[model samples]
Target: MSGVDLPGAIRLVRANNVRALDPAPAMFEGMLRGWEQQQRSRLLARKTINDRLSLVRRFAEFTGTYPWDWTPEDVEAYFATRLSRGEVVWSTVRGQQGDLEMFCAFIADRRYGWAKACLEEFGRAPVQVCHDWNTAQHVAEFEGRPGRRAFTYEELQTFFDAADDRVEQIRKKGRKGVLAAWRDSVLVKQFYAYGTRRRETSMLDLSDLRHNPRAPHYGRLGALQIRYGKASRGSPPKRRTVLTVPEVDWIVPVIQEWVEEVRCGFSPGRHPALWVSERCGRLGVRRLDEVFAAIREHADLPAELDLHCLRHTYITHLVEFGYPERFVQEQVGHAYASTTALYTWVSDEYRNRLIEDALQRRLERGGGGTLMPQ
Candidate 1:
């Protein structure tokens, strides 16, 4: 495979080759290139490609060959290694397994003639070995601790107040403070107020905003059309979400200030993103991280309170306030009721209060104790 002929030969192999028997290194490289091309055309972003590549590299390293050589046993062994390294989170382990399984399916689709039967044979095999292993590990690690951690209303209020206070202080400093700090304050407010996912917040364009006529007299509600979410791709088929009056009231001013004052130098024609970097011309995940770091620094909140935590907080508050679970699920765009249920963690105190209220109501209705019971 000379340098001049390598590209052509690789293209030919990707177009015509299928059998995995006696697979050459060039063939494997060609397959990888083909996979890259497929991902690109399918609009699989770089972050996704990097994650799949990382998993593929790990599998290749374990098997001492390309991912094409992986068997069902190889898959199990790889996860076993993860367990051995003390990664006991079921969700995390299951996620890695899913990535590998998807990769296997991709390879099989491309190399159907070579390993179609073998792939089909193992496709039905349980992939939950990793999940089970991680579950056991989680149980053993947290043996004495409670199954779930539920924050009290007071605690929730304290966290939000602290975040809000920090934002106000940052904003008071004007442009003297870091641009990233200002950006993060906006994000924290958005997450708490709107219950938006990190990716949703990141993908938001200026054009998503609209006026809501039903906002209360004192405040304004805004409508946001979320076209791209986890379930779909390519910014179409948008769903409308009504932002609360308070959230709209807070975000509109900040956005206006950012556009007119802080963002005055950048041309709206050239840069259409709602959020932009002070240092770079474009904003992205890196900018999002910077915003998060600022929030973490100023709020004195726990390290676990990332952007996603805001969404969790929003749902938790809603459930605690007696919002219908179905309504909450629809607002958050959750596909399953069970998945939405995970966010509704009520504290023991609240549950006890509800029980007390019910007992009081029963007594008030003249439902007597032992002697007077009907």
Candidate 2:
């Protein structure tokens, strides 16, 4: 279709097609327009639209029918196809399911009749898919396979140490290398320390950091105001989270050094984005995979760990350290306690140590410890 005729063509298609009642196309179109409008408003990055469109196209292709005609069976079959293609893991399927559900809802709202029918037939297809997907993820987690590996604390530490060594090597290579090296290190450290989602971290601007005016020794913390996060319904519905002291201490210096020494005399205006790229101008989630890969190469670490694992590790560490469940939930910005709990895996050694320590402490407190009467 010609660019000028596209809208007219879409209108004609909508008018003639019974499936147009499905609302999926209209809703999808609206989303496309909304994304464009958002880009015009500079409220969203263009890449966001690109990414959403890519997923929307994939969903459309997978559904094999218009939105109005979509059935729960289609969703099931789509996932089945993915599994047969060796994409059986719940995480991947779950992510695609979320995208599809969003698209479905978008369409359903506009085409009430189709929406009602689909909803009645599917009996809340999205919710069911999400529930099943999560269950599958848990099953996969418990039944870990060879390719899916969880990192031990030692492995994590080794990776960090190797990353540090690489940073030193980069510094020796001079100005640009030094700045880039430091930035990567800071990014990696911040990922682990804050347990931040990749998008959240990428969205960070320089102003996101709060400096303590009262104390001279106080450093900048990666504190995000509620205004700048992924929120439901286009509003910041969740509370803001503060990065740990370690994250603050670790990242601030590197950032300051980069700003003062390397980014010297350069300002990107009021933008507080901490991460930028050579070409993309701003960093986003897609770029994180490359960053992780680079870090893996430098550290000689296995490629299993992704950016999300930092957040997972942070949650696991918090649980291991005796932090209250609620506290970890708040720190990680989890909407639900159960979501936070998924990341925590209690090791047998730690469990035994906790029991032993508790017994010893009880004995000291005159509770008779292990010899206590039943």
- Of the candidates shown, which would achieve the greatest lDDT relative to the real structure? 2
lDDT of 2 by residue, 224-256 (tens): 343355555334335475644443355566666
lDDT of model 1, residue 337: 80
In model 2, the runs with Cα more than 4 Å from the true position are: 1-77, 91-151, 171-176, 211-217, 222-227, 233-239, 246-255, 265-271, 347-352, 366-374
Off by over 4 Å in 1: 1-23, 34-50, 67-71, 86-88, 102-111, 116-175, 178-183, 216-220, 232-238, 245-271, 279-283, 369-374
Q: After superposition, how far is residue 218 of candidate 1 from its true place, in Å?
A: 7.0
Q: Could you tell me every candidate's TM-score relative to the true structure?
A: 0.69, 0.66
Candidate 1, overall lDDT? Answer: 0.58
For residues 89-146, what per-residue lDDT tens digits would candidate 1 score against the true structure?
5656656676666555555542323233324433421121223333233333232213
How much lDDT does candidate 2 score? Answer: 0.60
lDDT of each: 0.58, 0.60
Model 2's TM-score against the true structure:
0.66
| Residue 303, model 1, lDDT | 61
